[model samples]
Target: MTNSTRSGKRDRLAGAAVRVLHEQGVEKTTLADIARAADVPVGNVYYYFKTKDQLIEAAIAAHGHHLESVIATLERLPTPQERLKALVHSWVEQRDLAAKYGCPTGTLASELDKRDDGLDRAIAKVMGELLGWMERQFAAMGREDARELAVALMAAYQGISLLTNTFRDPALMEMEGHRLERWIDSLA
Candidate 1:
């Protein structure tokens, strides 16, 4: 196949993997499910990812890149406060998904933390990247306890995600999102 086609196929597979992995727990998602979601044959999955673990690695990388892009866009806003609020807003917009499946990174990390294959470290690093980004934004706002503030903010988010999913209520996420935005403003 041409390089462009090959790359497109792999990207599709990775994208599908991320979505499937988020919607279904990692324990339940199979290469066949990803192949179906990507509209590729199950046999062809081996061409790009030799094993399920390899595909999950690619998916996690894709998820990280997507997070970075979102953070970059938030950075374009004028102030640190606005950037942080925008980040919350972006997440709040996914309330329905959050209610259905919980925070993508949080759920994935929670599940993978049980494995002994070291994927727990990979997911932890992804979570750390998020916390680190939040910490930087808080630091820019002149917070002395930037890391603490970052952890607090993320704790609120993950907590609400679990509550929302457990209750099957998007309204819980929306309410908590507003509260988190207000809390960020208070910090400012």
Candidate 2:
């Protein structure tokens, strides 16, 4: 296969793994499930990943890349405050999926935290990247307590995501998104 073809298959596997992991959680999602989801042969999964842990790592990396894309998109807005609000709105736009499967990154982190294998650290790094982006936005807005505000913002998102998933209610996420936007606007 050409390098582009190989890379495409790898990306397909990683994307399928993310979806399977989100839908079934890490414990229940198998490599075969991912392979089937990717429409690749079961053995082909081993071509890209030696173990389920490696695949999970790939999924986490994909989420990190996704977070970076989100940050890049937000950077296009004219003002820091608009960027922050846009960030919240972007997440809120995932309310339906959040209601169905919970926040993708948050749910993966929570599930991986249950294990003793230290995958939680990887999750923390991914979460930190998002928090750092939010912090920079707040700092650009002249907030002295940018880190604290960022933490609060993420806390609110995680909290609402948990509630939205538990209740299977998308409106809760929308409501919280509006509330967060207002809170962010109130920030200095």
Candidate 3:
């Protein structure tokens, strides 16, 4: 295969791994599962990722890229407050999936934390980037306790996500999203 085709396959494999990891959790997901999801031959998965850890790392990178894309989309808004609200709204939009599978990053991080595979720090870095972005938004809004506010806001979402997933209730996320929007407005 040409280099371009090889790269395309690798990307597809990474994307598929991300989806499978999100759906099945790291311990339960396998290389064959990711290959099937990517529609590549099972053995071909080894061509791109030598081991499961490599595939998991690729999935984490894919999630980071996805997060950056979402941040770029939010950046198009007029103000930091509006951008923050848009972020909350985007989570509401994923209520159903959240209820079914939990927050993608949160769930993955929680599962990875149980293992001694050294993936915890890498996953934490990805989550930290998100918290840092949220903190910057609050700082832009002139909040004296920007970091605290950011932690509170993120904690609220994480709490709601856990409850929503546990109860199988998307409405909980929707309610929390509205509450978060109002809270953001209150900050301004």
Off by over 4 Å in 1: none
- Compute the lDDT for candidate 2: 0.94
**Per-residue error at 107 for model 3, in Å?**
0.4
Models 1 onward score TM values of 0.98, 0.98, 0.98
Give the range of the ten consecutive residues with the poorest summed lDDT in model 2.
179-188
Better of 1 and 2 by lDDT: 2
lDDT by residue (tens digit), candidate 3, 82-178: 9999999999999999999999989999999999999988989998999999999999999989999999988999899999999999999999999
Which order, best to worst by lDDT?
3, 2, 1
Error of 1 at 20 (Å): 0.9
Per residue, candidate 1 scores C-alpha lDDT tens digits across 16-79 of 9989999998889999999999999999999999988998898888888899899889879999
Model 3 lDDT, residue 122, Cα: 90
lDDT of residue 102 for candidate 1: 94
Candidate 2 local lDDT, 1-188, one digit each (tens): 99999999999999999999999999999999999999999998899899999999999989988888988888999999999999899989999999999999999999999999888899889999999988998999999999999999999999999999999999999999999999988885
Worst 10 residues of 3 by lDDT: 118-127
Q: Local distance difference test, per candidate? A: 0.92, 0.94, 0.94
lDDT of 1: 0.92
